[model samples]
Target: MQKVIIFTDGACKGNPGRGGIGYYLISDAGKTLKGSKSYLRTTSSRMELMAAIEALRLLKFPCKVELYTDSRYLADSVNKGWLNTWLASPFFLNRKNEDLWRRLANEMQKHQVSIHWVKGHSEQAQHRLVDRLASRACNSPKPLIDPGYFFKI
Candidate 1:
């Protein structure tokens, strides 16, 4: 079986205004699936978490996955097991993006996944692709961009 690799990034226009999550998924045999979507009244961090959530959800069955992301908040939370500690503490009650973190935790339980923090805007071409997709989405409000918007992707 082929390994599953996912590259993700999130873009925000105004921090608390609109944001987008971009994900690039590729299988070991060269098959690929990738897209980005914009969300109203969302933060980049939320979208960062959402990108991973949506990317993992693409799998019909669990497999070994290497998820690459530019956001340290997303990577460190999962890879360092900070999410576990948060879930057990009252601090999680007031933590930002708790809902997404919980959802991420649930999605993670279903697969053999590892989160890797990749430096933003480096030599990785795929990262640039995801960044472009996400930024494009963040620049709009539908119809003018694409009909399906990203629901189809």
Candidate 2:
């Protein structure tokens, strides 16, 4: 499978407020691709998960993905095996951001994915770039509404 390296970040004005997600992807062939989106109402975790989901969705074929994120929630869920447990447990249905988790779970089935955690606001240029992208996206004049977030309650 083709290997890809992806760096993602999410930012929110408040715990549950205007938010944005960004991802930077580099293919084995050295091609680069990036994406960012702003949400009118959302949480940081949701955007973080969305960043990975959106990046995975962009892949036209199955691949080996090394995904990096600043959110330990996103990384640990997969890296520490919470995701597998959640998928097998009915109790996960009541968890916050279950919708996005399920979407991310489905996306994972399409690729060989490994999630890594990185320190936020660090000196890493990739993290800094995606961080800036997400932060800037939050200021989009006409941000899109996060439907799942609205229905979260």
Candidate 3:
């Protein structure tokens, strides 16, 4: 079975404020697959989910994927099945990051994926790289699009 590894991180200048996501993918033989950073004028949760969704969508082949993210919200929601219930009735009260979550759920169905939560800013090399990328994306002067869903809130 082909195997891939992904590391993802999200950063917010302020809660519900400017944010970004960063991710890097590696093949089973330790070859780099892809690395990306995205800016968002929104919350960290959305960035977190976007990171995962974008990483999954970047895959060119169907393979067993092991994804790592620092966000418990993203990791637990998927691994523990909470995301499925939310997708079933997405309009429930207190729902947030709906668009990103929906995108994540859809991308998730395309591959055999497993999520692992890692401590942010820890000793993990990939996590550290993701953090650096996310910080750069958040601090970069480039104009960012307001992820659209914020106006619906």
Q: Flag the better candidate by lDDT, 1 or 2.
A: 2
What lDDT tens digits, residue by residue, belong to model 3 across residues 1-153?
Answer: 689999998887876666777889998887885455556567777778877888899887788999999899988998898988887773643577676777887887888999999987889988999888877788767737655445542
Winner of 1 and 2 under TM-score? 2
Per-residue alpha-carbon lDDT of candidate 1 for residues 1-153, written as tens digits (9 for 90 to 100): 348999999887776657788899998878999988888767778778888988999988877899999999998887788999999998786776777788899998888898899999868999999988888888766612322223321
Worst 10 residues of 3 by lDDT: 144-153
TM-score of 2: 0.97
Error of 1 at 69 (Å): 0.4
The clash numbers for all candidates, in the given order, read: 0, 0, 0
Off by over 4 Å in 2: none
Off by over 4 Å in 1: 143-153
- Taken over the whole model, the C-alpha lDDT of each candidate is 0.82, 0.91, 0.79
RMSD of 3: 2.0
